[model samples]
Each structure stands twice: as structure tokens, then as C-alpha cells.
Target chain A: MIRPLAGMARVGLRFQLAYRSDVIMSVVALVAQVFLLRMIWTALYGGREHDPQGLTLEALLAYLSLANLQAFATTPIIPRIAHFRIRTGMVFFDLSRPTGYLPQMAAFQAGHTAGGLLMLAPAVPVVLLVGTITPTEHPIGYAATLALGYVISVMMSLLICVIGFWTLETAAISMLYRLVSHFFAGTMVPLSFFPGALGVLADALPFKYMGYVPAAVYVGHLSGGQIGQAVAVEVGWIAALAALLWAMWRRAHRRVVIQGG
Target chain B: MAEVVRTLRLYWRLQRAAMRGALQYRLNLVIGVATGVAYQGSGFAFVWVVMHTFPAIGGWSLREIAFLYGLRLTAHALYVLPFSSLIGLDWLVREGELDRVLLRPLNPLVQIMAKRLGVGQLGDLLAGLVLLVVALPPLGPASALFCLAAVVGGALVETAVSLALASLSLRTWNTIAVRVFADDLFSKFGSYPMSVFGGAAQWALTFVLPVAFVAYVPASVLLDRTGELNVPAPVAYASPLLGVALFALAYRIWSRQLRHYQSTGT
Candidate 1:
């Protein structure tokens, strides 16, 4: 089991490197995204007369910048893999494997995900460049929380893509998911602008676990207690979702065997 | 002209089929609607958030901005739902499906687009209606007329532009990049008042992207707001002319591209 898993993971690395052009384009796209978000956040910060509820413009900018870079780097791997399998007939060949389907795919994807770290490769320099251009008092305490935030974002994306086990419309699902996540989780802009009661509600949603939490950490916005709870929720979500995903895959596999889908 | 009508009719049939196909998956359809609502809701949420940060954007108040946004979404949905394939034009082109469309009777461009209506449009329309209601205080009867002319007219023009992009798909091997590039650019343009971007950005939006006519013109009148950014009130009243002009151009382009379309072997 270990050897086969290791071999599959190794193959995933080769698969990613072979598509170097795609990797470069993806990195370029992510860089464009970083610049776009930074500009938008700058505009938003410009609008702020005061950081009521304790938001500093620099902290907010750093939060957004880090979250943008981290999400671009760590996530999107599952949707990428799931889309190819469904669009082509590779799922059939994969089922012929002795290994469990999703775990194998996840392991394979973990290797592919390394290429995504290119997004983060430029993040520090750009943030420093951004810092020099406009000083924002970002604290170091935010680092650990931001790390947990990456975990949350990747786990949520995996949970969402696991829906592909049951649904064939992965593109539509993925598009909708990304749109909602970007909006509700403060990926495009901060969620602070949401109305009072609603802002609270938005923060409560798992959607924020994707973008807001990371930004929250980057800006040192989360309290130690809040960080603890956030990590706990993220871990709990991963466990609960992993179980749900396994159950969904089993149900879907039953149908696949019966109908050969 | 006859080809246009025939293409529209074929498009209607394909639209019906697409709707039926969507309806067949009831569970998927329900989730899809929810997803769409969340998707659109996020954009509105972004606007709501931005407004909180700034009292006004370039003299456009929250209600007035909402009015423009409402018009923007309505026009966008009206065009996009009916010509859904515009975004997917590259795929259709690359797959050699455009040749099947070109081989058909009536306008081949119409044949290509007739089947392109996206059902998620219903979500956009409903969302726009709610926004219109919210924005009603700033709007008057004259503004309503402008909104009518602008949104309905704008949808037509936008659809024509989409069709024009589809036409490009025939010649350009990569229509997908165009779709992505265009959509990304317009998403930002559509969300904000074009006037806020300065004269150059505004002009580019009006003549180059054409989104300004869709949202800004009608929104200006409806919001009862005036600035350097507002479209001349007359432009809002006759927005449909823009759509007609674009549609004619798109048709001409499609006809030229069709002569070169070679059918694919599936």
C-alpha cells in the first residue's frame, strides 16, 4: 500500500512538471490576481475614514495580500484533478486500481500541489514591495494563524471537490463555489463592509474559513482564543468532511458498478 | 435578415432543450439555483461592503449605485442567458461544433447562438428585480424609461458582442482565452460606475468594451445622479440602437468567418 501510494505521488510530480507551460501560465494568472486584489484593497482602505472595530489599513492590506497568495498557492488542486477525470474517462481506469479512489487521488494531488507554491514564492517580495510602497503595520503574531488558514482553505476546497463523487457537473459546481467563496469569504474585498448583523453572520459561515481567517491572521486580528477555536473548527471540519466524502464515494461507487458511470 | 430570424428560431429550440436538460436533473438544478444565488449575492455583498467604507463613490450614493448595479445585472442576464455559448465559444470552436452550425439553414451564427441560453439567468433577473426595488427611491418615471431602454437595449448589444466573440472563435483557435479575458475585465467594469475610473477608462468602457452603455447610461438617469461620468441622457433613451449596430457587425463577421469554417469529423 505504501509503495503504490508513493509511486502514484511520484507520478503526480512528473505529471505537473511535464505541463510546465500550464504551470507558468497559472503562476502568471495568480500574480495578476495578487495585483488586482492589492489594488482593490488599497482603494477600500482609502475609503476608510477610521478603522472602527479595530482594522488598520496596512493590517487589512497585509491580510488580504497574504490570503490571496496562500489560497492561490495551496488550493485548487482537487478541482483540477477531479475535472480532468470526469471530463475524460479516466475515472474508469482509476477504478481498476486496488487502492481506494479518493485517498489515492488526494495523495497524487499532494504532489501536484507543490507546483502551486510558486504563488507563494513571490508573495514575500511583493508584500515587502507593497510595504515599502505603502507602510502597513502588520504584526508577526499573524503568521501561525495564517498557516492554519491555509490548512482551512485547502481542506474546504477538498471537501467541495469531493462532491464530484456524486455530481458530474464539476465545472459548474467549481465555478459557483469559487464565486461564493471569493465573495463571502472576503477574497475579493473585506467582509467588514457587510452590514452589522450580517457581517457577524458572514464571519460565522465556513466561507470565511477560506479567505477571511487567513487575512485575519495575517493582520493579527484574531485573538489567541479565536485562533484556537478557528483551528479547532478547521480540524473538525476536515475530519467530518473526510468522513462525508468517504461515504459519498462509497455511494457513488455502488452506482458506478451497477451502471458503469 | 431572414437568416437572423431563422437563427433566432433555432436558438429558441436549443434553449428549450437546454432548459429541459437542466430540468431533468432536479437535484442538481436545486443546488445550482442555490449556488447561483450565492454567486450573485456575493457581488452584491461586495458592493454593500465598499459602500460602507466610503460614504459615496464619485458622488454616487449607495442607493444610486445600487440602481446602476441593478441595471447592470439585468442587462447582463438578459444577454448572457440567451447566448450562453458566448463564454464557451472557444470550446465550441475547438470541438468543431461551429461547422455543424455553419452548415445549417438560416444564419449559421444564429444557429450557433440559438442554443446558448443559460438557465441561471433566472437567478440574475430575480436578483436584479430585488435590487431595482431597493433602488426605487432615487428613480423616477423618466429614470424607469431610461432603465427600460438601457437594460433591455444593453442586453441586446452585449449579446451581439458575445456573438461577435463567437465569430472570432471561428478564426482564432483560442476563443476561451478571449472569453476569460473579456469576462474578467467586464466583471470589474460592471461592478463600479465607469465614471469613477476617469475619462479615459470611461471612454474605453463605452467605445471599446461597450459595458458603459449597459449600466452607466441608464443608471445615471435612474439614480438621478449627474457627474462627468453620466451618459448624455439621450444616449440612455436610444440604447437599443447600439445593440442593433453591434448585432449587424457581429452578423457580418460571422458570415465572413463561416466561409472559412471547415466541418470536423466527430
Candidate 2:
């Protein structure tokens, strides 16, 4: 089981490496985005020592920069791949293979994520040069929550991909999901900036674990107790989403139809 | 002039066919437009949230910023409505699709653009028009007319930029990333008041990318904030003409690059 997963991962890594130019361009774009966000935040702060959200400008910049980097690292392509395979009637071949489709996909996604992180190394220096980052006091806690966040993000993305079994055209749906998740995840602005009821809604959703929680933990916005709670919540979401995905996959497995000749 | 009119009429017919083809995917078409609206709406919502916390950004009020955002989005929609198919230029070039395009009597650019009518951008147009109606300050007849002209002009500027970048695909270069990056720069920075950026960044956006000409200069003119503009008031007023000029130049580049195209011979 482990050997096949490892072999699938190698295939995924090779696929990613084939798009080296894309990785370089993505890194450049990420740096530009971090710089743009920095400028916008600085302009909004207007040289003020204090902020309404109770964050200093540096802290806010740190949170945003880290969030952007994290978002870049965990970019999901499984849904896109699934949609394409299903649309092109390639899923038949995938199913005929001895390995389980879900596990194979998960391994491929892991490998793709590994490639993204490797490309991310170049952008880190450029991001640091863009602005100051608030060092996290609890590095171990930050790492643990971030790992949990990555798991939650992958599971959520796979859940969306599984829906492609029903709807062959998942492109628009996936795009909509991305836009909604990107906002609710606090990649654009901190959930702390969300006013009253909106804040409550963001909190209620599991999307926050994907971006906001880890970044907040990194910038020391969350207390140790809060980090513990976030981890617990993230684990809960992972279990629930995994169960839902398992059930959906079973249904999807029975319903799979080859579309084109 | 007669030749030009005939070409345009033919172009219109081709575009209608493309639209009909797209409409066949009824569910995809509806979802695509809704997704476009939600995409642009959520972007503006982020700004709205930011405005709630901070009184203003770069000395522009929320209403004024919304006006600017609407103008940019409307122009973007207009540009993308016709030219969205050009985003697939790399694929077309790689697959030697241009070999077929060159056999047509009309201009290749028109043929490529007429491949599809972007349904998603229709939603952007809807969202932008609503914002313009809600956020626009009362204006004189001339100013209103100028706003219409500015939207067309801004669309031309965006078209010019993308067209020029996409021309690289004619040489079989994979330019999707760069093209997307350019689009991102426009949507992200073009909505903001230019004064918010530092001098070098502002100058680069204006002179290098010409993103400033898309919506910022015209919005500044309409908002009566030309006094704060880096360029003179006359330059701001004449900003629309820059679009016409840039588009003409970009078309020349496309033609020149097309001459260098080599078929993949698959």
C-alpha cells in the first residue's frame, strides 16, 4: 500500500516539475501580491501607531504575509484534475487500477503540495524583504496547528472534488468555492476585522482553520488556550469531512458513467 | 470604409454563432455568470469590510472608492466580454489552430476574439452597472457622457494590454501565467486610488503597465479630484485617447508577431 502511494506521489512530483516556469511565475506573482497588500495596509494605517482591530501595522502585515504564503503553499488542484478526468472519461482507467482512487488522489495531492512548498523557498526571502514579520513565541504550536490546517484544507478540497461525480462541469463551482473560501478563510482580511454577525459566521465555518487560525497563531494573536481549541476544532472538521467524503465516494463509485466515446 | 463595415458585420455574425454555441451549455452558462458575480462581489466586499474598520483608504471615501471600483469592473467586463477567448491563445497556438484561423478572410484577431462571448463577464457588467448607479454622484450631462466614453476607453486599454501579452503565444510561448498576472494586477490595483501607492510604484503602474489609464485617471476626472492627480488636468481628460492609441499599437504588434508563427505540424 505504502509503495504504490509513494509511486503515485513520484508521478505527481514529476507532473509538477514539468511546469517549472509556472512555479517561477507563481512565485513572482506571490511576491508582487505580498508587496501590494503591504502597500495597501500601510496606506490604510496612515502612519498610525494604533489600529481599530488592536493590531499594530507590523503585526497585521505579518499576519497577511504569512497568510498569503500559506495560501500559496496549500493551493488545491485535485478538484480540477478530478473534473478533467471525469469529463474526458479517464476516470474509467483510474478505477480499473488496483489502488484505491481516493488514497491515490490524496497521495498525489500531498506530492503536489510538496512541490509547491519547495518552490516557496525562493519567495520567503522576498516576502521578508517586503516587511517585518512578528516572530511567533510558540513555534511548535504554530507548526502543529499549521499541519492540522493543511489536513483540513486538503480534505475540504477533496470533498469538493468528489462532487464532480455528479456534476461533470465543476469548473465554475470550483471557482465559486475558491472565491468564497478565500474570503472566509481570511486570506484577504483577518476574520478579526469582520464585524459582529459576519465574524460569528466566519467562526462557525471550518474555512477559518485553513488560513486564519494558523496565521493568527503565528502572529501571536491567539493565546495558547485558543490555539489548543483551534486544533481541537480542526481535528473535528477533518473527521467529519473525511466521513462525509467516504460516504460520497461510495455513492460516486456506483454512479460513475463514461461520457464520451 | 466600406470594407471595414463589411468586416465588422461579418465579425458580428461570427460572434453570434459563438454565443449560440455557448448557450447550449445552459447550466454551465448560468453557473459561470453567477460565479463571476460572486467573485467580483466578494472582492468588493473585502474592501467594504475594510472601509467599515477604517474611515477611508488613501484619502478616498467609501463611496468614491466604490465609484472607482465600479468603473474599473465595468471596463474590465466590456474588455473581457469579447476577448475572454483570447485567454486560450496558448492552447490554440500549441495545437496549430492558427493555421485554420489564417485561412479565414477576416482579421485573425477578430476571428480569435469571435470564438466566444464571455458569459461570465456579463455578470461583471451587471455588478458594475449596479454599483455605478448606486455610488455615482450627481453629474452634468457632459460628465455623464464622458463616463460612458471612459468605460469604453478603459475597456480598450485593458484589451490593448492583454492583446499585446497574448501575442507572445503566437511564437508558441506559454504565456498563460504572465497573462493571468497582468489581469490580476489590473483587478487588484486598478480599483484603488493611485495616490495610495508610493511614487515609484505609482509611476511604474502608470508609465510601465499603463494600468492607471484604465480607470484611475478617468475616475479621478469624474470625481473632480483632478487637482490631486500627478498628471495635468488636460492629460487626465484626454486619457481615453490613450486607449485608442495603445490599442492601435498593440494590434500592430500582434500582426508583426503573427508573421513569425510556425505551425506545430501535428
Candidate 3:
């Protein structure tokens, strides 16, 4: 199983790397995004400031910049690809395969993300310089949380993509995901800044664990016990999502009506 | 004159067919529209959260910013309504569907423009109108006409920028990322006033990408606060002309790129 997964990952990595233009474009897009965020935050934090929500100006800026950078690197294109395949009737080949569909697709996307992150490495320096941010207190701990965050994010995206099996309206599903995540995922603003009801809603969503928790841990907003709890939540969400995806895949695969060919 | 009439007739026929095909997926269309509403709702929620926390940022109140947001959103909806098919140019080029389009005895670009109707933009249109009504800036006949022209201009600018960026597909054979990058430049920055940005961003939004012309400048004119970003009143009033000029330039570039296109032999 590991061997097949690894092989699939390699194929994904190579396929992604071959699209040199996409790699370059992603880098350029990330840099432009960092600039945009810097402008917005800098303007927001003009002069007289008491750090709202217990965050210093520097910390808020750091989290905003870093969260955006991380989100940019981790955005999975597999759903879009899956949509295209399903629409073109090419998904039939993958569905007919004997391997566990989830593992194969996950490994493939993981590999693509690895390549994508490599291309996105320049964004780190850009963020550090523009945001004037520093390293977290516990580098290893931050890494662990970030890995979990990536897992949950990828799993959630896969769940969204699996909707293609039932309906080729995957773009709408993905757009809905994009729309909700902007508020719920704490990508656009810190979840702490959300008003009472909205704050509660953000906390309840799995998306916060994907972006907010990881950035918060890196920025020292979550420490020790808090970090532990966040990771546990992320893990729990991952498990729940995995089960949901399993059920969805079973149902969606049954309804797959191959078109074109 | 006869050629113009012929093109218009063809566009009308193409639009009807496109609408018919799109209506076939009734559920998807409904979901798409609902998704648009939800999308706009979240964006408005973000603005509400920000303004609620702070009275004003960059010397603009919530209502003022909403005026800006409304103008931009409605302008974008206007663009999406007629020309949303431009977003899918990369796919058409990649799959060689463009070849079949070229075989038709009409302007390939016009056919592309007429191919898909973005019915979902109706939701955005409604949302934008609601915001504009809420902002409720003082409106005289001249200002109202100015506002209407500004929205149309904003739409033209957006369409021009999208077309220009998407035309890269003619050479790269894949320009989805580039097109997305262009779209992001507007949606990300168009919400706020140009004064909020640094000197370089302000300059870019003014002369380079000109999203400032889309909403912020127009809003300033309506709100009676020109030169806030140092844009002259004359240029601010020329938003419609600017949009038309930019679109004309972008279309010229797109036409030139079309000559470079080689079929993928579907």
C-alpha cells in the first residue's frame, strides 16, 4: 500500500513540476497577495493603537501575512482537476482502479503540494521581510501543528472534490468552500476579532484549525495547553472528515455515469 | 452598419442557446445563484466586522466604504453577467474547442463572449443594489447618471483586464493562474479606498491596473470627495471613457494574440 501510494505521489510531483508556468505563476501570485495584505494591515494599524484582541500590531500583521502565505501554499487544485476529469469522462479510469481511491488521491495531492511548497519557498522570505515577523518560540512544536493543519486541510478539500462523483457542479461546491473559508477559516481576519455569534461560529468550524490554529501557534497566540487542545480538535476533525469521505465516496462512486466516451 | 446589426443578431441567437443549455441544469443554476448570495454575504460580514471594531479606517466611514464596495460589486456583476465566459477561455484553448469556434463565420471573440450567460451574477447584482441603497449617498440627476456610467465603466475595465490577461492563453496554452491573479488584484483591493494603500499600490491601482477608476474614484465623485487620492476631478469623471479606452486596448492585444494561436488538433 505504501509503495503504491509513494509511486502515485511521485507521479503527482512530476506532473506538477512539469507545469513550470503554474509554479512561476503561483510564486508571483503569492508575492502579490503578501503585498496586498501588508498594505491592508499597515493601513488598518495606522498610528494610535491599542492591540485589540490581545494581539500586538506586529503579531496581528505577522499572523495575517503568515496565514495568507500558508494558505496560498496549501490550496489544493485536485478538486478542480477532479471536476475536469468527471466532466470529460476521464474519471472512469480512476474509479475502476482496484486501489483505495482515497489513499491514492491523497498521496498524489500530497506530492503535488510538496512540489508546490518548494516553488513557494521564496514567499517565506517575502513574508518575513514585509511582515517583520520572527520565528516561533517552539519550532518543532509549530512544525507538528502545521503538519496536522495541512492534513486536515487536504482531507477537507478531498471531501469537497468527491462531490464531483455525484454532480459535475464541483466548481460551485469549490466556490462555496472558498466563500465560507474566507470568514470561517480565519484567513481574511483573526477569528478573535469576530463578534460574539460570528466568533462562536468560526470556532465551531473545522477551517479555523486549518489556518488560524497553525498561524496562532507560530505567532505564540496559542501555547502549551491551548496548543494541545487545538491539535486534538484538528485530529478529531480529521477523523470525522475521513469517515464522512468514506461514506461519500461509496455513494458518489455508485452514481458515476461516465459521459463522453 | 449592416455588419454591426448582423453581429448583434448572431449574439442574440447565441445568447438564447447558451441560456437554454444553462437552464438544463436547474439544480446547479439554483445552487450557483445561492452560492453567489452566500459569497456576497460573507464579504459583507467581513466589512461589518472590520467597521464595527473601528469607527473608520483611512478616513472613510462604514457607509462610505460600502458605497465603494457597492459600486465595485455591481460593476463586477455587470461584467460577469455578459462576459463570464471569458473566465473559461483557458479551458477552451486547452481542449481545442476554440478551433470549432473559429470555424464559425463570426468574430471568435464575440462568439466566446456570447457562449455562456452568468445567471448567478443576478445574485451579486441584487446584493450590490442593496448595499448601494443602504449607503444612500446624495443623488441628483447628474450624479445618478454619473453613478450609472461609472458602474458600466467599472464593468468594462474588469472585462478588459480579464480579456487581456486571459489572452495569454493564446501563447501559454494555459493561463488560468494568470487570469486568477488578475481577478484577485481587483477583488482583494477593490473593497477598500485607494488612499489606504501605500504610494506604490495607490499608483498601481490608479495608472497601472486602474481598479481605483472602477469604484473608489467613482465613489469619491458621488460622495463629493474628489482628490482624496489626488486623482484630478476631470480624470475621476472620465471613468467611463477610461474603461472604454482600456478595453479597446486590451481587445487589440487579444486580437493580435489570436494570430499567434495554433490549433491543438482535436
Give the winner by TM-score: 2
Question: Residue-wise lDDT of candidate 3 within A1-261, one digit each (tens)?
Answer: 689889889988887889978778767766776677666666676754587778877888788877877777777778887888889988787777777777878988999888887777766787678877897896766787888888988898888778777767689888888777656768768888888888898889887866788888889888899888887887898899889988898897778878885
What is the C-alpha local distance difference test score of candidate 2?
A: 0.88
Candidate order by lDDT, highest to lowest?
2, 3, 1
User: For residue A200, what is the lDDT in candidate 3?
Assistant: 90
The residue pairs in collision within model 2 are none
**Could you tell me the lDDT of residue B135 within candidate 3?**
92
The Cα local distance difference test for each model comes to: 0.66, 0.88, 0.82
TM-score of each: 0.81, 0.96, 0.89
Give the winner by lDDT: 2
The lowest-lDDT stretch of 10 consecutive residues in candidate 1 chain A is A131-140
Could you tell me the fnat of model 1?
Answer: 0.38
Off by over 4 Å in 2: A47-49, B260-264
Model 3 sits at a Cα RMSD from the real structure of 3.2
Cα deviation of A166, candidate 3, in Å? 4.5
Q: What 10-residue stretch in candidate 2 chain A is worst by lDDT?
A: A47-56
CA shift of A32, model 3, Å: 2.0
Candidate 2: tens digits of C-alpha lDDT, residues A177-239 = 788888898987999999989999999998887789898888888867998898888889889
Give the better candidate number (1 or 3) by DockQ: 3
Per-chain TM-score of candidate 1, chain B? 0.86
Score candidate 1 by DockQ. Answer: 0.37
Q: Count the backbone clashes (under 3 Å) in each candidate.
A: 2, 0, 0
